[model samples]
Target: MVEGKGEAYLLIDVGHVLTHAAYIARVEGTARLAAVAEVTTTTAAEGGLLDGVRRATANLELLVGRQILDRAGEVRQPRDGDGHGVDGVVVTASLAPLLRVALVGLTCDFSLASAVRAATLPYVSLERTVSLEGPGDAWDAEDLEALVQEPPEVLVIVGGADGGPVAPIREMGETLSTAYSLLAASQRPAVVFAGNERACRPLEATFAGVVEVSAVANVRPSPEKENLGGLQGELAHLFYKRLGRSEGLRQLGTWAGSALRHDLDALARTLRFVACRHGLARGVLGVDAGGNGCRVLWVRPRGPALNWAAPFGLGSGLGALRQRRDPTAVVRWMCHPISWAEAWDRLSNIEVRPGGVPETEEDWDLQQAALREALGATWQGAVRAWAGYAEGQAVGEADMIVARGTSFTHARTPGQAALMLLDALQPTGLVRLALDWANLLPGLSGLAERDAQAAVQVYDNDALLELGTLVAPRGVLRPGSRALRVRLTVAGEERAELDVPAGSIRRLPLGVNERGRLELYPARGLDVGLGRRGRGGVVEVRGGALGIIIDARGRPLGLPKDEEARRAALEAWQREIEQA
Candidate 1:
């Protein structure tokens, strides 16, 4: 175990399909990533999660030219005098089943909404919701019996203002107690009470000895005030408790001690830190499209970060994505012609073999299409949730967007990833795009808690792959008309100039890390996030893999109704990005 602060740290991400490990050490006064390795995740039936972690660690040791594991195959902690071990170990994971949760609340609009928002973690599955808002406030006999039959892992009881009515909450507590009494001890669900403070003691007494009861701050303290942080914290704590039940996780947790974190939680923390660390005026937006879930996190400088999760992604969640959206929706983004049955067959094949790589062009296109739809669905939910708390600025007004998970990281090319991001998020204004190519955000988050300087240095230097800056205007324009004029100057010399037409995308040649100046002049009706229409200015820009992308597709990016035209447009856009 690490005695105190350690210069060399080992970080691991135990994902559902893949496990990744990275070694970071202080080199010449700066934290530098020394090595990274990944291996297929091992299921519990295949000797538990540690098998995959050990394999990845072994690979990392080979790359770093040091032994991270001892003869016992356990991670050697508190670096040895001969440089045989790491000083600290940190782990983040998304390898467990979703936490089954039931929401019991007073009203649909206030407490219930807040509870839903709080439960928006990738590993949380809200199984049931019982709202006590109607005139017939008493619990139905059928409802109580259902709770007894298939009890959720957690019952989040939230309602009533801080000083408001307590009798209703107490009544609900009694109903829950009666249901808990009917179930076996092992079947009873833990209760989290986030209701009126006045009802806390009564609820505790109601469920005493019957089940675990944790009382947090009221979710809706007043009609105008909603505080969800305390409740979110409680839910996360419960999730960790449940995760500890796994033998592999428990062992890893022992080694990590206080440094272990849930993957989604860590990602959220990292985004918030990045936003605040950079003092971003617009904020940071992040999306993680994993094998089994998709998450969108929006973190501004000074407000509560908004998080949204959907239990659908590129791999195991592909089938769920088909059920969630129309089958045609996934087919719409395809650049090549495909029949409905063929598309359905491909999606089914992926559901059965989620970890399998795409072997054909059609399969690749289909996966990208599904990814776009999945991210779009998650982004819409985030927007709706943010609408209530958004202060003046629009939800899409982010200065930097970081894409994570295999959907972006494993794309065939950086250009493909950038196009998918632009199509999925459809952000407006001038924004910087990046990819968590190494899946290092979670580890960096844990590292930051222990070594802030090291985490910052590593994050700035190695964590993300800059995809360059994007300029997407927001307004309607005539097709083929000049939408914006751009002049690019690199190192005080004019490099390129072009006129961007409406309904088209253009890529400028600017190599990575190359500093440049861009001058934008918008059309009469277009607004590039400036104060007014046709208002534009020059901004200092940094280059990335895709360089400068001018997306003149307009806001709420629309596609042609005809399938042929749509395919043509998608193909054209792909070529535009690829050929750059």
Candidate 2:
């Protein structure tokens, strides 16, 4: 794609449930998608992770008419003169086990919060958090015993300002040393010190022969400032180190060279890249509702990206979701009638068969309902950490909302997928909706490490499947009252004029890639992102599979508490979009 390089490139993603491969080639200075294939993950097979990759590549070879895999069943590094193989390979994976970590800090509100944020990757699980904010400086006997009994893969110690007192930090290190002494050398956790600069050397010396030690910049350099970049980077490095322990991953990494990346890391990087590339003032929000976990990322132009991941998803993570929320919480989003016991049984079946598909309409509804709640919970966590919103508020506005994972990609219809996101996120103002249908984001991000221009070209041209624009006004009015009025013009001709009522959603037809001009007049109390209530103006809009969606159901979308009424309302809304 760049000047004198080869044309064909291969990208692979090994997820918990599936393995995906995409073939893209540079053509006339533009990256174009040639083919895509997916197969069930083979990490547990005899061949391990490489089996899944080879099978996916074998499928790609059939579609592209090339010999991507040689006689030995390994990926061909460089393309032959006749273009029988690929020029480059990039791999991103989420099939590895979650990295277990323990956090030790001086206080709950400051150092502990920073450590939690730094370890919020989807592949990371916090096994324990010890907050030493009480009167006594000595470590509790129970805490030390717990560490020895269940040693984490990594131990993160964070506290103190740059020039603050080091006595508490040194005491913390002494307690850790006592705990590490009980475990064998192989069982001792790696230590990462991200606290006072003065304590770094002492902590390293304390854990010298006990475990691996790494020191990074202070997470809270001062009471007024929090610098998380250094800590987050160090955690990522540790994650790679842990992942590299797998022989399958080791072999795959060798093939990928420097282009290998963790799935969530790649997703976050791509989200930031998209925000900066388009100069989006409101930024971009990405929700990945995968099988193993759910991730929510909000990337703005200037500030640090806010990320939240929970081990609650549609498949293997369903048990965690059940434990976290009341079972009725999921049932509340379903339009169809089903008993709580029956719903629970079906969910249990999904847990047993993580890769199984819903065969009945009720089963499908249950899965979607759970997906909404999982996404909502993950989003709430991110919002609480973002510092931008007050309590009980919808997600802030964004220029674009990108949806990933099978929950969205495999929806029965585009409208169904759009509704799921709209209900969960409840985004306000103007925003473009898109779906990562091909699961290409992680691979594209991996490719970016080798050729930035080629990656950007592919992302801009073929990465996301746009799902039209969303115009949601924020306000409360009577259910049947006027919420907003819209006049749509396409190709200099008037197309439609309608009044959208409160507590209702309306979709206007504009076709894919069609441009339209909208003249909007919000109600006296409603604001459609035009600065004030009742303010009216004209703005350009684009269309996609679902056309233009006008949601006037208020900012914090409310559904009737009465089960019958809720079902009726949900059914009506679904019919509206399907008919459109």
Clashes of each: 0, 0
lDDT of each residue in 218-337, candidate 1, tens digit only: 888888988888888887888888888878888767754444578877887888888888777788998888888788877777655667778778778777787864757788899889
519 in model 2: Cα distance from truth in Å? 2.9
Alpha-carbon runs more than 4 Å astray in model 2: 1-4, 97-152, 159-166, 183-187, 217-230, 255-259, 324-327, 385-397, 491-493, 532-536
Looking at model 1, residue 334 earns an lDDT score of 95
For residues 121-218, write the lDDT of model 2, one tens digit per residue: 65577779888878775577788788879999889999988888877887778878877887788888888898989888877777766776789999
lDDT of candidate 1 vs native?
Answer: 0.84
lDDT of each: 0.84, 0.82
Query: Candidate 1 versus the native: TM-score?
Result: 0.89
Tally clashing residue pairs in candidate 1.
0
